[model samples]
Target: MSTQFLDMRISSDSVQDTPQRELTSSSLFPYTFGDIGLQTASVSPSNVNSVRVTLNAYVRLLMAPSSNPTIIPNATFTVRRNGTTIFTTVYQKPANQLDITYEMAAITVVDFPPENEVLLGQIQYTISVSTNYGIGLGARSFSGIAVAGGI
Candidate 1:
């Protein structure tokens, strides 16, 4: 039941809505989506008018270093939306040691990597340090940085 999250990253989303209904009275539900509360669905007044729909997903997470990396089975891992775990994931720390490579393609983000990448909007991790590594108990602890963005 142990969980791990690596290469964690936060993403954002935005949805637009219009204040107009496109339905006819002939239809049982004059509202656009009936009772789904869609853009065309009446909000102010049930029979007054139509409306637009808008939704956005906000994402945010923390990425810290595990004080005891040498003793841990893996450096870092990733957290899944469906509550799953992935192994051998790499986490970039706050330093010049991080590596970056770019290729022109259909994808617009690093999360699209085929070999060691993950889907959008997922991030979390855990680890165990050797009893002798780091500054003792303090060595196995690292700070997590918060990263978030979207296109």
Candidate 2:
């Protein structure tokens, strides 16, 4: 068995600041972080017996409590495989906290059968963030890897 690496990162400069009574959630474009939006990794159909996928997320935030010191943003991370939702998690933050960094991870395993395989098919993964209050994510990153083993 061997492993393949998948790296992704994304950043947005459009900062959103809303009050506790007027907060909204948004999704960043799905793609590799440093490169364009989509990234693909190969999956071996015939020789592989099972596939394992893992994800890691890092986020940077800029809190402006000085503007509305009573509100905090609730953040969540969602990961999708092949345009299908696979994992979701929420990031916890203290109400009075200022600038901070957040991190998370997810993992899953699946059987790889040659009968269901598509030629040159690739495994695609996406990471997105959702927030419920006033806060800005200055930068965000996601790294994923897949390991396939033969029977």
List pairs with backbone clashes in candidate 2: 9-33, 31-37
| Candidate 1 structure quality by residue, lDDT tens digits, 16-133 | 1222122221334211110111121111222121111112111111223344443321112232212233222332333432222111111111211211112222222222111111
lDDT digits (tens) for residues 1-151 of candidate 2: 4454322333332323221222244444423332112222354543344554455655565434434555555666666666566667665566666665343223232323232332334555566656655445544455555455543
TM-score of each: 0.17, 0.54
In terms of lDDT, the poorest run of 10 residues in model 2 is: 13-22
What does candidate 2 score on TM?
Answer: 0.54
All models: lDDT? 0.21, 0.46
Candidate 1: segments with Cα more than 4 A from true spot: 1-120, 132-140, 146-151
What's the distance in Å from true for residue 88, model 1?
11
TM-score of 1: 0.17
